[model samples]
Target: MGLSRRQLRLLMVSGFSLFLMYIMYSSKGDNPSSLSDSRESANSIISANPNAKIDEAINNKISKLYQQEQAEKAAEEKAAVDAAAGIKVTEEIDAIEEDFDPVKELMQIRALAPMIVFSKSYCPYSKRLKKLLTEHYEITPSFFPVELDKHKHGKLLQEHLAKISGRATVPNVLIGTSNESKGGCDDFLNLHESGKLATMLNEWGNKKLSVKRLETPSNV
Candidate 1:
């Protein structure tokens, strides 16, 4: 009871048409115009190359996936470029002459050559470190010292220093205009031990800084 070849062809075409109807029904909430165009294209493929409809469908899906991947890669590259651009944001700001801003004053002092030590007159840590810098190194431009206890806006400046540098204690050392702290007295000693202090001072002070003359004792 074998069916004729014409009858078999008719059955296959009818089954494929039912499958396409099921797909269209399932894509109900999607863009109607896009769906209509896809339906027309699928019909054209089926009409010209009856056996290739399944392959064409698979190829369309693969093409859509490739486009999505390319879009995601483009987004990631744009994010990377945006991050690089943000890295050059200026730390310095402009202000008026009459206005006495504590933060501005802090920036001005921190902007001094060689380095700046925001110290207290009575703090033994400050005394010891200052002595080391004066005796051991011939820093050309010389380091700037801000005696917070002697300043008019002492408490106010210290409060703001803590806010910016994240160091609340005496002997806060800033080696750059950006106010990047090099920690306190103990940290400075460690820098000397590691031989980075002399190297840094040479660049900032514009002179070859001398190495530690002797091992001074103070756990400040």
Candidate 2:
């Protein structure tokens, strides 16, 4: 028996609705699985052909640079302490002969005097030198951090020391009471090796005291 037109239309509508539901269900169920598969594929690619080493190298260099800078700052702080505590400097007698203001001249002389240093933040030898000086002499001396040549006078000082004192190294040292010693880390070590560091320092300290006493006479 043939169906009526309204009955056929109603049946067609119901079938179409069922087909659309099935399509929607299939899409929803497959999407999650498809996404998971894609993620897994990407992970495999990364694992098989890793390319982030450049990033690691860059990061390592950055970290190393930061560490170096921090170390330098620490050394400078130590030096500042040493300087404030009184490290003597010596200048050429003839260099400032023309305009010798005793007050200012004395100040410059103190600044240019021989100083003992242990280490600079940027120099490895400076570390070793500092340790030796501390262990052998029990003095920290004045510290100088020659990392980037921030003090323009350092060049001139280095040149002067090189030309006059014949020593030109970051850890170079001058010892004795009058600040007359001119040597470096090697010299310090040599003195320690010879068991003369302590004796020399004592003698130098005595001389230094006497000189200062003479320089500043008492009313009595």
Candidate 3:
């Protein structure tokens, strides 16, 4: 029983129409506005139609976007950590005086240079070092007691001296003579322990006295 060519053609057309109607109905059944709506629809279509290229495209885009965002976030977090690590904290200075002359002080006593001790009132090491200076040696007014908390001047002075002397720390002790400047509390202690502070002071005083002799005009 062979069907006529016209009948076969008509039957094929009907079947194709049914498939097209099914495709249209399935596509319209789900909303396409939100990601979740699209994802659910994609999943349903993929399960039913494994060879769907359109669903695979959408998934690839989503995965690529996720990876890019994760890398950017990781970079930002690393930058924050590096910034925290690189941060430097400086010691705070309270106040600076309006009229404080360093030159006049330096010139007096024929340049009888002071052992400048940068100090903070609450610092125990500074206190102990000061006590040691007083106990072991003759600390004159030239032994400048610079309080870092009381004024910024002390901190500035300490910084200036540090740069000139090639060292940086608190409780800094300096012995500036007519010709040379020696640094550090430990150095001073070493000299003092070795019975050298007295000798050095005497030598400095003698040098100043000799300098005065050179400066004065002899009554020939």
Q: Residue 113, candidate 1: how far off, in angstroms?
A: 3.1
lDDT of 1 by residue, 99-127 (tens): 55787787677566557888999999998
Higher-ranked by lDDT: 1 or 2: 1
Please, what are the lDDT tens digits per residue for candidate 3 over residues 53-89? 5446445655665676688889999999877665522
Model 2: lowest-lDDT 10 consecutive positions? 211-220
Error of 1 at 33 (Å): 99
Models 1 onward score TM values of 0.46, 0.36, 0.38
Candidate 2 residues 21-107, lDDT tens each? Answer: 554334334354577776766666456443354345445655665676688889999999878655433234345443434434223
Ranking of all predicted structures according to lDDT, beginning with the best and ending with the worst: 1, 3, 2
For all the candidates, what are their Cα RMSDs to the real structure? 19.6, 24.7, 19.0
Q: Which number leads on TM-score? A: 1
